[model samples]
Target: MSTMAPACGAQQPGNIPTPFDWWPFVAAPIIGGALVYVWTNGIPIINGIVGASGAALGFSTLTGGAAGAASIATLVLYYVLKADGCIRSVPKGANICFSGIVNDTTDENSTAVDILAPFAMGPAGVFDVVVKSTYWHYVTDDSFWVYCDDAGAAMLPCLVKSETACGGHIGSLVGVTVGAIGGVILGYLAAAAVGIAIGCTATGFFYLLCLIIAFIIAAIVAAVVAYAGAVIGGAAGEGIAAAANANDPVVKAWKGLSPGDIVTVQGNWVTDDSLGNNEIFYTTSINRTGNVGSPGPYTTAQADDAIPSDDCNSNSNPPPPR
Candidate 1:
C-alpha cells in the first residue's frame, strides 16, 4: 500500500483546525474568577462559605466569641477615650520640665527605653517611655523620642516635669491599611479552600474568591479591633513603678500615668477600668496603684467588676456606697 499526495485542486474534504483565539482563554479565568468573587459575596451563600471555612479552620481559633470580643474591645476603647480625654491625654498639669536636657538610654536586645529628666527639685527621674506598652515585645528605641522646647539646651537635666505621650498613632494608621491588603489575600485563600470543597464551578470559584477577600477586609477590621485591644491591653498591663516618682509633682498630678496609660487612683488601687468609675475615688488614695490593663479593673476576686454591680470590690474601687 502507498500513500499519495492529494492534488492542489483536490486538497479535498480534509478538515482543518480553527486558529485558537487567546481572548477566551485569557479572559475566562479572570472573568470567571471575578464573577466567582462577586457572586459569592451575596446573602445565603456567603454565610455558608464562612460557616464552612470556620468549621474547616476549626472553631477553636476563629470563634464568634473572638470576633465579638474584638469588636466590643474596639468599641469600649473608643468610648473610654471618649468618656475621659484624660485617659488618652498626657498629664497637662505640668508640661515644662525644668530638665532642659533629656537623657535617653535603650536596651539594644529588648530595646527598653528610659528617659531621665529633672522633676522639680527632685533628682533626675528616669521613666519608661511606654509605661503601658511594656508588654509589647517589639518596642525599638525609635518607638518614641523626646521633644524639647530647645534641643540645644545645656547638659543639666532641668526641672523635668513632663508627661508621656502616645507615639505610634500615625504610624499605626498607615500599617492598618497594609495589614488590610494582606488580610484580603489570606481571606481569599481561606474562602477558596472551602468554596472548592463544595464543588465550586470555575465561575463560582472566582465569586467565592471575592468572599474570602471580604473576609480579609473583615480580618483587617478585626485587626482594627485588635488595635483597641492593644491599646486597652497595653494601658491595662503595666503601671508607674511605685518607686519611680513618689515625689514628682508632675508624676503625681498625672496620677502616675504614662503616655497611652489610663489608671484610676481610688483608695490605693489602680484600675484601668474603661467602664468603671476608677477615677471617682482618685483623691482618696494615699498610695495609688500603677497601670493595669489585661485583667483590667476587675481581677478574678472582683466578680463585681466583670458585671459591674452596685459597687467595685476590695481589690479595686467599689463604686462608692450606693
Candidate 2:
C-alpha cells in the first residue's frame, strides 16, 4: 500500500514538528540583562554581548523562560531596592559634580588605574555616621569620593597644578657646580702645599712669580671643574624633571593634591559593585576650588556651600532625607 506518500512534508504519525521554539523569546531578555551586568562592571560591551549570547543559546525551552524570568526579577528587585533606599544603584553615565575636602586617598591599581580620594561632604564624624546609618544615603553619598584620572588632568586647574612639576632643578644644578669647584680648589691647594717646600724659592720675586702662576692655574682648574660639573648637574636635573613630567597627567595631579585643599570633582557617576555599591565619580575634571586648610568635617550648611549650584545636590540639602 502506498502510504499516501507522506502528504508532502506533513507531520508524520509520531514525529510532530516541535512547536516553533519559544526559547529565543526568553533568551533575548536574559541576554540583555547579562549585558547590563557586564557593562556596570566595566567589561567591554562587545565581549559581554558575545559571551551573553553564547550563554543564552544553551538554554532549552524549559529552562529559558525560568532564566529569563529570573533575570527580569533580579533587575526589578535591584531597582525597587534602589528606590526604596535599601540598595544603591547609580546608573552608568550619570552626570556627577560635587566639592569637598579630601580625607584619604587610595593609590592607583591595575583595575582602577587612577588615584581614588575619599573626601568629606559634611563634618566627617557626623556625615560618616549618618551615611552609614541612614536609609536615604545617596543624596549625601556623592560628596565623599573622587577619582583623579588622566582625562581629568587635561582639564583646567589640574593642568595648571601639574605645570609646576615640569621645570628643571636649577637650584640643584647650581649647588652641585659650586660644590665641585670648591672641592677642586681645596684638593689642588692641599696637593700643591704637600709637594712644594717654602724654601724651594731662591728669591722673594721668584716666589711671588710662582705664587701668581699657582693662583692662575688654580683659577683655571676651578673654572674647568665648575663648568664640567654644571653641565653634568644640569643634565641630571633636566632628566629627572623630564621623567617626572613623562608620567600620565593624573599622576602629576595626584602629587599636587593635599588633605586640606578644597576640590571640585566632575565626572560620570557609577555605583561600584566591587566596592559594595559605593558611588564613585569617574573624573573628567578636578578643580581645586580653594585651598582652605582642614575646611571640613563641615556642618551641613557648610557642606552645602562647598557644592556648586549647578551640581547634583543643587535642589536638595544633605542630612538624611526629608
Candidate 3:
C-alpha cells in the first residue's frame, strides 16, 4: 500500500489579508472626476460625467468623451477591486495549507531560489502555510493576496470560521481620499492651463491649433489623474500592513517605549528554515537612571529617565535572555 503525502501547498495559519485595499481603487477616480467637474462648472454632481468626458475627448481622437468617461470608470473599478498583500514565508519540503478564499497562482523563479506554488488569494481574503526543509536554503519570499485560484495546487483547504473585516477599511479610505483629491486638483490644473492658452492666442488661423493644444493638455491631465488614482489605490491596498501592525500587541507595547527604558522581546525573525540560516533576534537594554555607562535595573521610577541613545548599544546594558 502506498501512503499519500500531505498536500504540497498550504497557507500558514494566523496570516490573513486585509480588506481596505479595495476601496481606494474604487473611490479615487470618482472623487477625481467630481473635483474636476466642480473646478470647471462649480458643481459636484455632474463632475464625473462632464470633467472626465472633457478630459478624455480633449486628449485622444480614438477615445471620445464617452469612451474617456468609460475608461476612467473602468480604471477606477479595476483599482478598487484589485488585490495586493504581503507575502508569507514558506519552509521548503513542507506542504502549504490554504484557507479562506484562494484565487489564482503564479510561478516565481529566481537565481537565488525557485519558488513553487505562488498562489493568489483572491479578493475575499486568504490564509497560507509553507513547508520548510531542514537545510535552511533560501530566504522566504513575502507573500501576496491574489485574484485567482487553482494556479498553485500547493494551497490546501483548512478549517473555516467566521471572517473578520480587519485593516482593509482604514487602508482603503486613506488611499481613496488622498488619490481622489490629487486627481481632481491635477485634472483641473491641466484644464485651466489649456483654457488659458486658448484664451491667450489671438491668431485667426490658430483656432484649430488652440483646440488641438487644449485637447493635448487635457489628455495629459487625465493621464495624470489616472496614474494618481492607481497610486492612491495601491497605497490604500498596502495600508493593511499598518493596520495589522498597529493592532499587534508587540507594537502596542513598543509604543510606550522611551529612550532610557530597557525592553526584553522574544525576538524571532522569519527566515528560510530549510536553508539552515539562523533566526534573526531583536534585543534592547537601557540604563534609565543615568548615561550610557551607568546602568540601572530598569525600575518603574526610571521610566521617565532620559537616556542619551534611543536604541540600546552593546556596551550600554544587556537585557535578560529569553
Candidate 4:
C-alpha cells in the first residue's frame, strides 16, 4: 500500500521542528569556561586582549563591582593582592637566597641595600653601565625600569623574597576579567534558555509575563555568576602564584644595612611603578658574611661619601641612571 503524503500544516511523526534550537546556547558556557581556563593558566596574548576589553566594557572586577557582593571582591583584590595597576596585577610572595657584596645601602625613606653579585641578569658587573654599554646584555625593552629589568632581577638567586613578583600580576588580572565575562555569558544563556522554554507555552499576556520573569531571572543569574567567577579567578590566581613561590628559600629584609658590607640579603623584589622606573628589594633579612662585625655598618662620613654624587664619582656599583 502507498503511504499518503503529509499535509503542509500537519506535523509529521518524529519530525516535529523546534521553534528555537537550544543547542547554540551550549556555546555560551563552553566559551566562558574556555576563557576562565586560559586566563588562570596564563595563556599569553589572547588573555591580555580579552581581559583589557572586559575591563573597559565594565565586565570585570577591576571596574564594575561598585557597591554590592561584587564590590567586596574588588576591594579584597585591591588591598590584599596590591591591585594598584590601572589594569590590576596580583603580586605573589616568594623567597630567595644568595651571597654578594654590599655595593651601596640607603635608609632614606625606606631601608634598602644594593648588592654587587653575579645576578642572573648576566655576569654581574654594573646594571646601569651594562644596560647602556653592553649590547649582549640580558636587558630587554620589557625591563620594568629604564636601567634595570625586574624579570632578570627576580631570577637572581639572592634577590627577591618572591620570585614570581615580576610578571605574576598579569595572571590575576587575566583570571578575574576572563572569569567575570565567562560567568555572565554562561549565566545569561542558561537563564534565557529556561525563561524562553517556560514562556513559549503562553499567549500575549502570559508571554509578556514570562518575558518579565525571564529578564529578572537572567539579571539575577548573571550577577551571581559574575561574582562567583571573580572569586574563583582570585583564588586560582593565588594558587598559581603560590606554586611559583613554593620552592624558593625564605629570607628577610635587612635592617641597619650599610654600604661596603659583605652580605647575603633577601626581601620582596618589586618594581616601584608609582614613583619612577625602578625596582626595590624591601630587605627583610640580612647576613653579614664571615665575622659578625667584619662587614659592620659604614661610618657616618663614609656613608655620606658613598651617597651617589652628581659628578658620577660615587662608588655605587650600578649608579642611578642619568
Candidate 5:
C-alpha cells in the first residue's frame, strides 16, 4: 500500500498468493462471528474505546467497536494478508498507515504495525475503526457495546421498531423471531405429547385447545421462515461473490492506497504520534518513478522520460523547482 509519505525506502518483498487462500475467504465471516460470542462480556482490553464515539442515533453505541478491533483486525488480517499476498517490509522511513482501531495514540518515533500487517507503524491505540467499503462493516467498542457489520450493530434499532424487521434489520430480529417460533413449536409439540399420554384430543374443550395450538405453530413457522430467508439469503449472496473471487488475483487495493502520484502533504504523519515531535511531511517532492524502493500493489506508470525523479534527499523536499 503506497502511503501518502515520501523518502520511500525498502524492506522485504510481499508473498505471492496460492489457491489455498480460498479457504479464508469462506471462513472469514464464520470466524468473525464466533469471536463475538467469545468476547461478548465487554472486551476488557479496549472497552473504553467503544463509548469514545458515543451513540450515533441513540441507536448508536460505540460503532466499529462492538467486536474487539484487535480481534477483528487479527481475524481479518490473517485472512486478508493470505488472500492479498501482501508483504510487510521494514519501516521504510516513509509509508505510515496502521489498520485496526488506534486508541490513545501516544508514541515517540516508535513503530506500530498493523497486527495483520507486518509493516504499518504501530504501538499506538485505536479510538475506533470504521471499515469503509462496499458494506457498512464496523465495530463500536467504546461506551455502548462492540458490534460488527449491520447485524451486530444495525439490528438493535430495528428490533426496537419491529420484532420482524428483515433485510438490514435481520441481524437484530433473528434472535427474537427465531426464538419465538421455536418456543411456539416446542409448546405445541409438548402439548401434543401430553395429549398422547392421556388421550386428551377427545376431551372436548381440550381438543379445541390442541387445534388452536397447531394452527398457531403453523402460522409462526411460516413467518419465521420468511424473515429468516431474507436474512440468510443476503449472506448466501455474499458467499457467491467470495467463491467467485477466491481464486482471482488478490485485489490489493487498500483504501486510498496506490502508487505513482506525489501527494502534497494534505495530512500529517509521524512514526508514532507520541514518539516524536518531528512529523514527516513532503518537505520536498521525492520521485518514486523508476525508484525500485516503492511499495505495491503497483499502479500503472504515470510519467515518462521527460519527468525527473526527485531523490529522497532533504534538498528534494519542496523540489527546488520544476
Candidate 6:
C-alpha cells in the first residue's frame, strides 16, 4: 500500500519538442524546388515553341542566338540604367556629378567625373541634357577641382578635392557593360546548346530523355547567367554609393580630423530661461574630435545677445537676479 501511491508532487509535462519546430527548414527547400521546376519548365517550353516556329520560317541558328543574346543584353542595359540613377529626373538646377579615379584610362590626363544624364528622352528633356564634368588640379593650392554643367549652365561648386579620387575606379556603367557583354555571350551559347539538343531529340525513342537533358542544361545556363548579372549589378550599385559618400564634405572633413584633434564647433546652445539672464546663446568651445568628445577637452561658453527683457516680461514681472 505504501509503495502503490506515487510521490505527492505537482505533475510536470514531459519536455518533448514538436516536429513543427523544423517546418521552416523543411518547407523552404520543398517550396524552392517546386518554384525552380515550374520556372525552368515554363521558360523553356515557351522559348522552344517560339524558336521552332522561327526556325521553320527560315531563322537560322545564328539569328536565333543573336535574338536570345539581344534579350539578355537589353535586360542588362535596363538594370544598368536603373542602377545608375538614370531612370529618374535630375533635380532642378542640380547637375549630377560622379567622381572616381579612372580604373582604365588610355591617356595620361585621366581625372574625370562621369556625368549621367537624367532618365527622360526628348529635346531639352532629362536624357537630352548633355551633362559633362571636367577635373582640374590647382597648382597653387595643390587641390583638385571639378566643374559640372548641364547644357552649358553651371551647377553647384565642386566640393570634392582631387586626392580623394585615388581609390580604384568602379561605377555603374563599368559593371553593367562588363555584365551585359558576358551575359549576351553566355546566352548565345546556351541557345546554340538547346538547338543541338533538339536536333538530337528527333532520333528514335530518345525524345523524353533528350527533352530532360535539354531542360537541365538550359536551367544551369540560365542560373549562371542570372547569377553573373546580379553580381555585376550589385557591384555597380555599391560603387555608385561609395562615390557619392566619398564626395560628401562633412564626411571628408570628418575623415581629415584624427583622434584627439581639438576642434571648435561654432553654434547656438539653447538653455532654459531660468538658468540665467542669457538663455539663447552662441559660443565657441574646444572639444576632442573623432566621433565622440573625450573628457579633459576644455570647453568654453559664451552668451549671445538676449531677447529684450520687455518681450520676455510681458506676462509677469521678471524674477530678480539670483
Count of clashes, each model: 21, 3, 43, 11, 45, 0
TM-score of 3: 0.30
Candidate 2 vs. true structure, TM-score: 0.28
In model 1, where do residues sit more than 4 Å from their true spots?
Answer: 1-165, 168-174, 197-249, 252-322
Is candidate 2 or 3 superior in TM-score? 3
Q: Which 10 consecutive positions of candidate 1 have the poorest summed lDDT?
A: 93-102
| Candidate no. 6 TM-score | 0.27
* Model 5, total clashes: 45
lDDT of 4 by residue, 1-322 (tens): 1122111121222322223443336544654565466435634543454455442222222112111223323432443344332133323333333333343433222111111100111111111111112111112212332332221221121223333332233343454455555545544455545654675455676766665565455445555654555444444544565576564443223333443554444444343333223232334455554322334332323323333232222233332222
lDDT of 1 by residue, 1-322 (tens): 1122111111213332223445446545754554354444522434554565554433322232233333433333333332122244321221111100012321111112222100111112322221111111111111121221122211111122222212122222333334433333344444445444555454764755554543444444445544443443332222232233346454454334332222222222122222211111112221223323332222212221322221223223211222
Which 10-residue span in candidate 6 carries the lowest summed lDDT?
123-132
Model 6 clash pairs are none
Model 3's number of clashes is 43
List the candidates ranked by TM-score, beginning with the highest. 3, 4, 2, 6, 1, 5
How does each model score on lDDT? 0.29, 0.35, 0.32, 0.35, 0.27, 0.30
TM-score, each model? 0.24, 0.28, 0.30, 0.30, 0.20, 0.27
Q: How close is candidate 1 to the true structure, as a TM-score?
A: 0.24
Looking at model 4, residue 245 earns an lDDT score of 56
Cand. 5 TM to true fold: 0.20
Assess candidate 5 and give its lDDT.
Answer: 0.27
The global Cα lDDT (0 to 1) of model 3 is 0.32
Worst 10-residue lDDT window for candidate 4 reads 114-123
lDDT tens per residue, model 3, 17-64: 333455557566765675465444554543554466564333232122
